[model samples]
Target: MQSLFFKIFLWFCVIVVLVGVSIETSSILANYYETRWQGVLHTIMPMEAEKCARMYETSGKQAVQNYLDDLQRQKSVRFYFFDEDGNPLLDRSAPEVVQKMALNKEGLNRIAQQNLSAVNPRQGIAMRLVPGPSGRKYNLAFQQSPTLIMPVSEAVGTHPYYRLLGIGLFGALLCFLLTRNITKPIVRLRSAASEIAAGRLKTRVAPSVRRRYDEIGALGRDFDLMAEQIEALVAAQRDLLGDVSHELRSPLARLIVALGLLRQASPEEAPEYLSRIGQEADRLDKLIGQLLTLTRIESGVESTQREKFDLTNLVQEVAADGDFEARAHAREVRVVSADACTMSGAPEILRSAIENVVRNAIRHTPAETAVELTLKQTDDPKKPGALLRVRDHGSGVPERLLSDIFVPFHRVEGGAAGNSQGAGLGLAIAERIVRMHNGSIRARNAPDGGLIVEMELPTSWA
Candidate 1:
């Protein structure tokens, strides 16, 4: 009773059975009455009575008796005869009730009025008269025993009760199958939901169920989407905790060492130790700030503050600042090309994202090398977006590790740019910000031997 499948199946069965029984009961009663009455009237039709009367006179009493007996055995009817003077022709005794009936003027007239057919208490009798060659009148009576009506022995087809049983069985089977089809998808959704509740976040309903074009199908698809979101959120939370722990350990350790040095150092060396401690504190503060920014972006707490602005100018400003900083290391940051692309977004957030990439490029490229920036309007009519590419002439990332470069705290190991120290939240935060703007970001090795980062934002944001 608790199972949805069983409940639907049983309810369908009850409805089918009730309807089938009602139909069969009414049909059987109607058929039985219609067939019985029609056959009863046919048996004692006036034409049949006349034919039997003629035979009785021509074939004589004995032969007529034999014919009547055959009719009685086949059609369940019997015959009685009397002379015109009211004398019995064949002395076969009939029941007293039939004798009384034949002698009564009212009963006889009633039978004649109906063409010699009449219904008594239990049976129907039909009678007729015929004339001999000498014009002598003879009276004839047809009677049935046990009941007045004759039963039709040769009725066609199976009995009505059996037919009803067959119809009920077929309806029950159809209902059972229909219920299974209706509830199968629900059963699968239930199982998947149970698994998910039991901590199996990856569980999902079958794809076929989701493809069904119905309300249940829509529910299944929506459930899968919810589960995916939950899984992503859980993973991001774990990654954030791990990233914070790893990134804080180095700065904290430097602070501890600086503190020990301050305790023993003379005044001349004390300032340097204090400065080192202050720098470590600054690094820790910066790391915490980056972590908070990443958390806000990843968790969607920081809603997009969109406004119209020129993305080209944003890129130029970031590149210009990077160029000023790169001069200290004999490196250059240059805007190779620019396009006039007006956009809508949180300008400050985009500025930070773009500036991080530009500075990182300048920080990693070899002294005397240049970091190149390009901005262009995408031509695709459907997308109508802007693209920004940042490339550095440093050694390109390893092919296998390129995919992991944007992961928070990820650093390229033993590459030409590996000498620089970074907490590695820049690209990760940049990617999140790009996605928030309904954009995409990716990194690849340039053909001329460097790393290239491309970012695209659609025109809807413009």
Candidate 2:
């Protein structure tokens, strides 16, 4: 009753079982009545007919009447008889009975036929006594008293009550089991949904593979899809914010530095200051352009045009650019190639990312220090990739902050002294561009000296 499915099933089972029991009970009552009627016809009726016959032959009419009267007192029975001409010879109770018998021509004819037949013919007892013989020569008609009908009614009524009660109990038990089976899956789905609502984005309803292909399985599948979509959207939003912030930081830093220089200069030095400001402005413009390129790449707006490209050539070009700034810082930039490496990606973006890494190494090293850039290819088929390593032997980064060094605007302690002109976004921008090309970049302290940054680009052609 506590569950809707249970209540409905219970009602249905009750109706079906009750109907079945009612039919069965009715059949049983009918069979019992038939048996009881047969007993009365075969045993009691025959015995009464024989008794009437004996009285008619031995003791005559007065003895017959006395015997019938005695039977009527003991049991609810009536008796009568007629002679061969179909005239009433002996009748109990009243003289009017003989006259009433004479009026019924069909009764008299049936009685006369029973007496005339050579073989004895038995008739079944009935609720109403029609005009018929009592299956004996002397007795013309007989019937049980009206009170005997009560037993048949009693048999039908009592048996149905027990059958209906049994049906009700069985239906209730079946309903409880059915309701529990259906609600268990619903409860699991509710719990899974609640967990997801509470920010457990990975939560999923366990699929019941054995269950039927019904509404419950559909709901579970839909819930899994919803949770997956929510997780994807949340992840995309976070990446968007991080990319935007990193892109804007470089240009803004250059502009700020340009303004600071202008504020601390004289009119005679205006030309020199203006030249520096122009250079910074150009740097800002270049930064903005690179940011737009990175944005388009990361957002999947621009499809990568991949082709076999020489990795060593790309690294040499990036090294040449870094060398230009390295010369100004009095640093020696060297490119060491171990083997000819090849890869497939948008060359422009890969070049930019590689250039950023080399530039950062050049900017952070000490004067006259050797900043080595090495390019190599590995033989691993599962990891067919080009490895680019840039190492700078200068004041190394703190071990504790090494992991966060690639984060945008995350400047370490040594960063302030060595790379004063940088906005701390180079490594961050490089990592994003590399990841957009399905590559990875990492920075770690070199065993011998300063920081070593490594970039790996997969070269799998298949």
Candidate 3:
């Protein structure tokens, strides 16, 4: 009973068995009463008695005797023919219980005078008196299997108990099938849960369970979603740790070398060595700042102050700053086109994200090659957002690593080989910012052989 399968199955089985038993018992009792009632036996005796009396009146005792003998052998009914007096014409031994009933004058009077039927103290025996031809009365008695009867086992095969047993077995089998159908999916879910708890985040319920059109199906779907989210979080955590450690090691090694140089150099050359040390320290500081910004954005710790702002103005401003800075290396930044498009989001964060992408382009594009910015208002049904494109005229990233270029600590093989001053967190931070505004960013090799970065920001958050 502690188990649901057993509880439900057993209850169903018991109910069905009880109903079957009740029906079989009622049928058996009805049949037993039908066979034993004196009225049932009497209903047929009058007709039979009349037939015998007519045969005796027309012919002799031989015809009537033949019918009596055949009836006794086939139906176990004994006939006693008598006149107005209490004298039996045919000699036949009465059963002892019936003999005693005959001695009760009051009972005999009730039977003969009222033409009623009666039973003796013993079961399976009944008596009735019927009027014969020529005013003669016949005493009729019927005994159920008096001397000849089938064996108990042979008779039981057709008894109600046998039918009841068959019905009970069928009910039990049906209950077992029903229980299995209900519990199988639950058991599978439990097993999957156990596997996931053991750190197997990919473990999931079988397709059969998920296909169910019930509450269990919904539960299975939820479990699968949870497992997928957990797997993604764990993978991201591992990647973050690996990237952080690898990025820190470079600056730390440089700082050690700078310190060693400061100690070995003469006092007159201390300023130059000290400058090298400060550069390494600045590199470490920038790396740590970028890592913190990425962490805050990814973890949702930094609350965004969303407000409506003109995106076209912001891009122009970022391009202007980038242009003034890129002039140092003879690289230029200019907007090729602009459209007044407004969006709702944290203006500061968006400014940072756009500035990073533009600066990265300026840093990579070859000298005297102006980094072009195009702000186009799109109405395409599939995109339905503003597309901001930044193109740098430099050796584009390899086709294989185009997707990974935005990953933190992931730099192209030779995209920035000549200039190794900036850390590789610019594009990664840009991607995070774009995602926070419910937007998307992607990079590809432009048709004219330069790297192009496109950022799409939705006009509406919903």
Instruction: Report the number of clashing residue pairs per model.
Output: 4, 0, 0
* Candidates, ranked, lDDT: 3, 1, 2
Stretches of candidate 3 off by over 4 Å are: 1-198, 380-384, 416-419, 460-462
Q: Model 3, residue 24: what's the lDDT?
A: 67
Q: CA lDDT, every prediction? A: 0.75, 0.66, 0.76
Preferred candidate (lDDT higher): 2 or 3: 3
Candidate 1 TM-score versus the reference: 0.68
Which pairs of residues clash in candidate 2, taking residues 3 or more apart in a chain or in different chains?
none
TM-score ranking from best to worst?
1, 3, 2
Better candidate number, 2 or 3, judged by TM-score = 3
* 1-462 per-residue lDDT for model 3 (tens digits): 335456566777776776677566556644555554545555666666567667767776777777778888886656554333434445566666655554454565577687666664234556555566676655555555542222232233347576566556766777777678678989999999999999998899999988876677778888899999988989988987987898889989988998998999999999998998898899999899988988889887654678888888999999999999999999999999987778888888889899989888888899989999999878775655789999999888888788887887777767731237767788899999999999999998887778899999976322
Q: Which regions in candidate 1 have their CA more than 4 angstroms from the true location?
A: 1-36, 39-198, 206-211, 415-420, 460-462
Kindly list the per-residue Cα lDDT of model 1 for residues 69-119, writing each as its tens digit. 786798766777766544566759866765655666455555566654444
lDDT against true structure, model 1: 0.75
Highest lDDT scorer: 3
TM-score preference between candidates 1 and 2, better one: 1
Better of 1 and 3 by lDDT: 3
- Model 2, range 303-356, lDDT digits (tens) per residue? 456667877777887788788878987887888664676777778777877777
